[model samples]
Target: MTFRSPFAIPRQLLTGTTSLGGRSAISTRLRCNQRGLATVVPPVTQDATGSKGPTAMVFMNMGGPSTTDEVEDFLSRLFADGDLIPLGRLQSYLGPLIARRRTSKIQKQYADIGGGSPIRKWSEYQCAEMCKLLDKMSPETAPHKPYVAFRYAAPLTETMYEQLFADGFGKGKGGRAVAFTQYPQYSCSTTGSSLNELWKWRNRLEGKRANGGSEPAGTIQWSVIDRWPSHSGLVEAFAQNIEAQLKTYPEEKRDEVVLLFSAHSLPMSVVNRGDPYPAEVAATVHAVMQRLRFKNPYRLCWQSQVGPSAWLGAQTSDTVQEYVKRGQTDLILVPIAFTSDHIETLYELDQEVIHEANNPGVKRAESLNGNPVFIQALADIAHDHLQKGELCSRQMTLRCQGCTSERCLGQKKFFAGQEQASMVI
Candidate 1:
């Protein structure tokens, strides 16, 4: 019966563990810990009073649909970010307009999944499942501290912090926090956004007279696994989910069916800007493809495009149409964009794209809902990170080299002070 903030971000705490390996460029250059694998996070130590702060986890995500007459207003805020969106000025006027126009359709789609999105509900489930799995997978830390912070929606960064503060949770016992991101992959937009928000929140907190955040409360000891796209257990979970979903399909048609892997669309601009989201999707798609016993080949596509700017690849809508034209009656759409079935998966795949190229065979593969395998994978990934100590290896961040984003709490700083001086004013 506890209510928490919708906004949650990752806090970088000094990991007490070591990082290992030097394979992927992302992992090699910037690991959760620069040294080696194997982090040593001290078990949660309880104190004298009745207040024992819990170990917390926050999932940084592109949140589900906002339930507001002002849903358009929410969309505008997303598209209006000067750094993320190319059309900031236009977004001020056009964002809400476009979002409002699409509201009914989107709203109806949400209705299909119930009155609201299943993200928070699923996340909470996953949290409980994660705890269960952790208890089984890593008995040493039987019940880890975890929390969810949605980027948008009612629970926001400001609100989560308020709850945390009121709960007697002040970064660690005295002043440190072992923060984690649920996503196994690290991309500028995904991992990066989470990191950025954390910094912003920390800075915002530092500015408040109520909580002087300047001093190290528990060093925001940052340990993030980033993205576990390559994790074998997770890949296996996908294989299992895909297998279970295909149950309704005729066994012989499995080969005939096309596996469409659809991820949330990112701006090609992020790639241009050095965010590795596309690569992350590529890795997930490839890994899943390898794991599936697909007699039928698959295609990797992107969907749910926002903003007026050019996005990364073939839109899911177009893909659907093309698949229909190609005479493929059966198709399975896999949304690896999110681990669970949220608004994007519900509305975009279930509603918008479903109608695009209506075919008798089109169906979306279920997202990773607390399925036992997938849930187990979550714990395995966490265990792996704990084994490796640090979540990522550090590489030189050009943005952070000389940047001065006081509120930017990322270990890999993106803005050099020199670059922001002109913008800071």
Candidate 2:
């Protein structure tokens, strides 16, 4: 069966499509021969002596604190990020103040959820397992080395980058790395922010000169798998989990159960900027429903909106409360956006939302942490990306309609220009 990507762009239109000052913005850095095609080094499938081992597979996500003790630091870093929170000139002052004020309460939330978030544990496991599969599925890029780069919390992006250098990846030795976003849907505040951070470090550590000079000859070649909202395997995993939850209800009430597809909410400011998250998230929900053959009624709702800003809604908690009050208590809350269990799932959905409803009829489907099906899906996504040798999805080349940040522009140019650096067998 042919699967269509919701963010799909035709291959022919990808190159020379985006421009700045009437010149191709992306391919400017690419080394093209007389024939006008990107010239790359020989593909690293395998040497005659042995396998082409140790391909770096970096999993990128906005991580949570592993213990209550780490909550303050986590919140501080989170609030400090202009990309995620955007506090203007007072960001340095207000970010720490906001974090300090909220730390105690947030710490308690972490305590309530068995000391802290389980994201770190699950992310490491998922990446490692996926790499094990990649070693077999794509032997050309065999011995895929798993690495996790969280935007906030321990094992942060900088720390992960340092490890890559220590592991003999980029200190004047050419290698390949793929930045695989853990978020299935793309969001500037999420995946885009992570990519920006990654690019920042690559420039800082890899000797990109102050005057915008290029890196050393033998540095790491980078590519990204930015978004995969409607992959068949991912849809199947979500559908199976929802079905398992539905089976707990009696046959008479099963068909009547409502599917509440919930994702972390984005601020209206970001939404107005033309962020692709909302549309991509809806794609995941629609694909899952199709996989289930539209067995029951469903609605996509938003959750985990922070601060006083107007956010995307009907909010998940409010949606659950109103439905229970209306005597439609049979509902299944599916966390569609997050691949692994975190505060949103364990504390917010379970502890706060469902607990407040006080109805057993209201339930949450299991998170996709350590689910073999989901892990296999991750491996499948990675294998396909490695085989294709595209720098990133064509969708990544186009910035948000209202984007003005130079960081976003530079990051896009650097990654998109990597067509020349990419290995094609």
Candidate 3:
């Protein structure tokens, strides 16, 4: 999915000048209608003389939509990835006119929900909560440091790395080293993007040279925490959410509800290229649903597709419509991809699906937001990863002792070159 940008540049970035709040004021002054986001400085750090500075933990992930104007930018970023879509001649066929027209409707969806996308907010909350959990369970030492660096937005990896370096994450946050990125689930798209960025950052730091015609940069001692698909606790959390949400409906409706599991859709051609995103989510969904063991029928489908490209088959809307055509009333739409309730599960499922599933006969369960069980599961999974050599399901470890790493970034051999700009210096 395309991620929206609230501004030309996020204000939290560490501009080279050390004047306190210098760039921030300039950014705000230069703002216009297009730079529509507020500029708020995050918490800062201090030195021996108590000079205030920055802190780090900029976790990175692809952002979701934020504003109407951002819809196209998000789509461009989404479709730009060959692993996400195969535009073919469709772009030329549909052309910019059609692309804009189609994307306008999608942007309105975000505008309706407040102005910006909720992924950034939800991720920040998750990062904070994850840090809190780590502090509680293990003091004096922490699990891998937590940060939220958006692949498409701020805190961008370079920006956050700069912020953390300034703040003391890695010789930046009080001179203590910082460790970023350890997403529980492994996917080339998510973990892959994070790993490549960190490696580039490290190259710039250590001054490692890029192979091919790429750039040279130092590197960060980033632990490549691979995706953990079968984390039983996390899987069980989904199971519990299904059961909890199902309780809202009477037993009769519960028995008939469709166990619809939804993940962000990728292009059909990209899926053909061996992107395991769909398969990874599916495996997790199946394992979780089996644990839940409801008598209802379930199906996996994709959502938030854009551009003229053909995405995975049976879009959520179409699938829901089909179910309604078949006379099903109660429908439980589980967000297997996201662990929290963001715009997708909220607006998409709530307004869009509720509207599309117009069968006066249909009903949907809200996404499993940061519910108690879900948060607990997240904390437990991280804890399990610490105890076991690899990630452990609530009940068992998914990886054997032989399998130490959590990801498979080199599976396809797509390499990234070092990219360090003077703006960061």
Cα RMSDs, all models = 12.4, 12.1, 10.5
Query: Candidate 1: TM-score?
Result: 0.74
Say which prediction, candidate 1 or candidate 2, comes out ahead on TM-score.
2
Clash totals, every prediction? 64, 0, 37
Candidate 2 on 1-425: residue-level lDDT in tens? 11111111223222221111111111111122324354331223323355455688999999999899888778777766778776566666666566677777778778888998888888887887898889889987776877788888667777777767766677776678899999999999999989988998888778663444465776888889999999999999999999999999999999899999999888899999999999999999999999998989999998876555577998898899999999999999999999999888887888878888899999999999889999999999998898887888888888888899888887887887644323211
Q: What shift in Å separates residue 286 of candidate 3 from its native position after superposition? A: 1.8
Q: If the candidates were sorted by their TM-score against the true structure, best first, what order would they fall in?
A: 2, 1, 3
Estimate the TM-score of every prediction: 0.74, 0.86, 0.69
Off by over 4 Å in 2: 1-52, 209-214, 418-425
User: How far is 120's C-alpha from truth in model 2 (Å)?
Assistant: 0.5
Error of model 3, residue 377, in angstroms = 2.5
Best model per TM-score: 2
lDDT of 3 by residue, 128-229 (tens): 566567566644334334556555544555555565554344442243323334344554456555555555555455454345634233223232234556
lDDT, candidate 3, equals: 0.52
**Positional deviation of residue 105's Cα in model 2 after best superposition, in angstroms:** 1.0
Q: How high a TM-score does candidate 2 get? A: 0.86
